[model samples]
Target: MRETSQLPAPGSGAFVFTAQEIRELDADLARRDLLELTMEHAGARVAEVIHARFPTGPVLALAGGGANGGDTFVAARHLHALGREVYVLAQGTRHELAGRMRRRLEGLCPIELLTEERLCAGLSKTRVVLDGLLGTGFVPPLREELTQWIRRINEAGKTVVSLDLPTGLPSDTAGDGSDAERVRADLTLALVGFKPGLLFSEVGEVQVLDLGVPPALLERHAHASCITPEEVRALLPRRVRGAHKGTAGRVYVLGGRPGYTGAPSLTAYGALRAGSGLVALYSRAELPRHPVESMAHRIEDWNALTALPRPDAVALGMGLGEDSVPVARRVLSWKVPVVLDADALQSELRGAGHDAVVWTPHPGEAARLLGIGTGDITRDPFAAARALQLAYGGTVVLKGGPSVIATPGALRVCLAGNPGMATGGSGDVLSGVIAALLGAGLSAPEAAIAGVYLHAAAGDRAYARLGYGLIASDIAHEVAPAWHVLHQASSEIL
Candidate 1:
């Protein structure tokens, strides 16, 4: 919720780690007593959420054999102790879970073998379906049976909560990969560290559960910008009594051709409202919208591009069209950090040689940039974002439903926001925030990290006021308040 412009780009929002990397982080946390403690904490957290929502609802814990399943047992035991009806469906044999995990679930609740018929019947009346069947160990393209079960759970409209990564979904961030299946959850609770799968996939509302993992350890393990409010607010500069318009940061937005001027205008407004001291729109003479506090300077020729103004950051590609192609080609040559968005997406975002950039592409635009169709990129946001990051040589912010921000080097998740943010023009506002942050000097990935959360948090605030009627402009207006609120919370913790 912190003002993203005030902070450096967040670490990667990918929860995914390579197999070897996963083993290392898990082992490290496990060695320090976090293995048992974190799971226990996660389970308890889920139990608390469920109990509060469906306090008296019969709980059916569909558990598997790994650590993910172990968390279910922990939660089931807690629920049972509180006198709630809890049933444990051991999807696999008892031997499947070994060591302390097995020991913890033993005799705590009624255990039953989850045969297809029994599973169906149990799911039929279950108030809360706790999916601990498969956690981070799950790979893509689930087996037929598991896929069927996931579908059933989805259509049944149960308040299904997945522990860690959703069952049937890949534990890695790539999501669905070559695998043809994924679990559609009502909620996914991330523990220890968030997985990239949740942020980019069809997984439901994600909630970051307390795993009791030490801040130091989590920070050490973090490769993405899953930073806390405190960390984000630390980046905001102190507004000394003596301040000038030129002191804050200068952002130059380019990429509006003859017809599409509103896009660039909106981006400029978003930056101005976001507290940028100076923002100039360096688009075709056609797009002339400007912030109320400032006026936009229009550029006509290519030679005037570099001569306009010395900007800290540049934003291009909003409402551009065929003519934008020639202009975008020239714009990319700029040395400053840039956010390639809207129509210029395909032309400007080449795979990987960028010095610093935040590429914003909708599914279709993403497809154009990657040389594929929209369906392919929409099918897997996590992978697409990563692909873009590697290809563009900078961070990629795959905008719209299940948005993802990826830095070529880091992996993390934005554990904020809601579903009420799918409105049009939202991407333009986001580009503005990101550009302003870059202008303020956060790295490419850092700007994206902050932008994702800022955009979502602003939407979350708008939801509180307008509900479904919210628009992109509303979200832009809400950013200032959200920033203050989040910043205040950060100040209190210190």
Candidate 2:
């Protein structure tokens, strides 16, 4: 879409469209005689990905009787030409295929009619499975027959590569049904652009493949955007020559109780690592130990915040415990940008209408704020993030395996980080990272996007060295290197 020769990276910051929107775009392309060209591109890309990612083994293409089937037929032809063993199992008779699809099917030597025995036997022999059975047009409550085929595919233990999206996954809403209902893909080649349904965990590793669609056509239908490394790199603040601590921006972290001193300490270190000029931790009790570089202040009441040096941005509620509601209310009233996390999210700050505020909440906290079940939040994180942004009137970071960042007008999904980052104090570190970026002069959305990426990248770095044992402090420790790596890459690109 951007007129680049390279394939769209997984997190290319591309616009995400719904299934209906994709169909509309397809119609538009058809009107201009570009529909067939896109199909060819899609088929070629699928074959290429299968060839590159998988070893030299038989590939079974599970094709339906529609446009998706047509694509599969095209891919089968390409794979056959590439000298790879290919098998086709069509959902229906040859008569069901449309004209274009029929021509593509004719190019293949032998096509087997799909059946229970054929599907199971083909899966057992094949090293890879290409799921072109259903694309963006799939609806919920899969037919019993197709469901069984999907079950066999999942159980076959073959590397499943899906075209567009995994079969049976609704292209619009994140299906809240059981995992067995849909085809579980090991890799999904998202054609044209990402669909909202691809945000789920089941989609696996997604790589967007452009069908040479015009950017304007896609932008017209897209409702959300993916957060990319290039965008985060550009958004990161650059330090100038001879800059001092006062000029670098100050950040104040407010949280921590008797047992939860480590939470605020992590936040303070996170801020410092993220390039905060100076960081101060204000808690109810003076901690005996904290980050040596940060100042620790004991505040008896909300009024004490007035006596200290004003911060450019404030991080609230890492471990504020019971005082979160009152502290959040008081700090939110100030004009400075604030990042709300942990206990602060329990506050009744709905509709505060402060655009500078950033709310970072996990599923449980989001459920509390929205008065819904935690399952509901996890079921549709995109909707939950949007709801939180609408209710709190700021950027909302819905933290999960893959976090979603929502603003008043935009939605961004960050596909970084690992399962190792799921350890304790991770969100607190994120809160401080975002707070530091806000203080360093990025807009609320910019800071949230860049900060989220940086935090995830740091977690990945830590995970690489420490494996699953990496803690939140390890993430904070890697922030400097992560920032340096991003900065270096940004400089090279510029």
Candidate 3:
């Protein structure tokens, strides 16, 4: 693992907004006395980001006719003032603050009305293109001219900096098209803050540009935060010199009948590796090798599981087959904080309200839990995660290409995992990691957030070394190294 935080804090405030949500935030902020000032602040921040990223360069600003275009113009003016050869390419009518910026930019730099021919010709000479043609409100099936321009710009392969969001990508949801159709930026400056769409793979190298939105102001408007590596590092359970087996954490992993012994063992191994001092696995006829650090106990039924001492954290359902429903019910009834996953979530929502329960489900399981189709869950994972959280009354980890963690008032997205983590036992391992955190005294939300981030970070590390061949076991083994990176990051900060 790398010995540093790959993802630094974007800002003190982190939230992923839908287009509508962003508009709402803007409206709420606009109601305050700082509307025009906010726009000005936004433009100034864009300029600052541009200058810091590529100082002293021949830069091209593709200005649209909206607020995003205004931001682009402001950046161009700033660059021009700093003695950089800045060019502004405008294609549409300038309106609102954009109109004001257009007049200002015309005084500072030549605002060229772009033809496709001119744009293609100009692209070869520019070092970087500030893409402000389309912003957060843009949707797919772009206009003919815009699409052609994006394609040409992408083909030209110049360093592109997008303002707010990449063109042709939906800000409200994940992009579902090939990269060719989307604006592939080298850097994306998220104005005011980032949204979920900006974190999409197509929107590369995101950095938050605070538009004078105070932390407290954002707190009033924002309901979600992008999980950061630094935050996860701080949330990890501290280790002491004389900490005993009981002091760290005790995690009980239960599941893995006949054909699925590996699942439970994987869960136990994950918990143990994630700083759990003692991990006990209760499996039905487990003969195959389990992690040596974890104690494996043979169990016939739920009665046998109940007979064992109540562990600090319980990981229920890896591969328990048909018995998962009863085991889940019996386990939840005991009032232990449980990380319920896989077959454990296969059953309908039941049992009295437990103090802490986390449901780790992929789209399929999430769909099943909500009685909706998997397509519905995949299409809007945020909504699905929220729905699952409301229905089941706990933190919901909606596992997907990018997992969404839904707690009561906040939703956090884990942008760490790759396609390499799509193997069978991956979710099982995640269940263990979360359980261990719960055992270590993190709140349900904190544990889910930290665990999801850690699991994805480990997968990313494993993928860096092993590529797509990374299996679930690789993810499990990489957990220790992942935590090491976090530890190294914390030490460096101190």
Identify the candidate with maximal lDDT: 2
By TM-score, is 2 or 3 better? Answer: 2
Q: What lDDT does model 2 reach?
A: 0.83
| Span of 10 residues, lowest total lDDT, candidate 3 | 1-10
Residue 239's lDDT in candidate 1: 57
What lDDT does candidate 1 reach at residue 493?
48
| Candidate 1: segments with Cα more than 4 A from true spot | 1-24, 29-53, 92-109, 120-127, 144-159, 173-187, 214-223, 285-289, 297-300, 306-309, 322-334, 347-354, 417-420, 484-490
Best by TM-score: 2
List candidate 2 stretches off by more than 4 Å.
Answer: 1-11, 93-99, 173-179, 490-494
Candidate 3's C-alpha runs over 4 A off are 1-13, 55-57, 139-141, 229-234, 238-243, 350-353, 417-420, 460-470, 481-494
lDDT of 3: 0.80
| Ranking of all candidate structures by their lDDT, best first | 2, 3, 1
- TM-score-based ranking: 2, 3, 1
For each candidate, give its TM-score against the true structure. 0.79, 0.91, 0.88
User: After best superposition, candidate 2 residue 15: deviation in angstroms?
Assistant: 3.8
TM-score, candidate number 2? 0.91
lDDT per residue as tens, model 2, 1-494 = 01111123334657788877888888888888888888888888899889988859999998887778878888888888899999898866352333466466565656888999999888888999999999876766778999888888988888999898889888866666567878888888888877877765456677888777888888776767778788888888988998999878799999998888889999988999999999989999776667999999887787777666668999998888989878787777777899999998874778653888889999999999999999889877888899888878889999986788998888888766877898999888999999999999998998999999899889878978998899999999899999898888744452
Name the weakest run of 10 consecutive residues (lDDT summed) in model 2.
Answer: 1-10
Q: What TM-score does structure 1 among the candidates reach?
A: 0.79
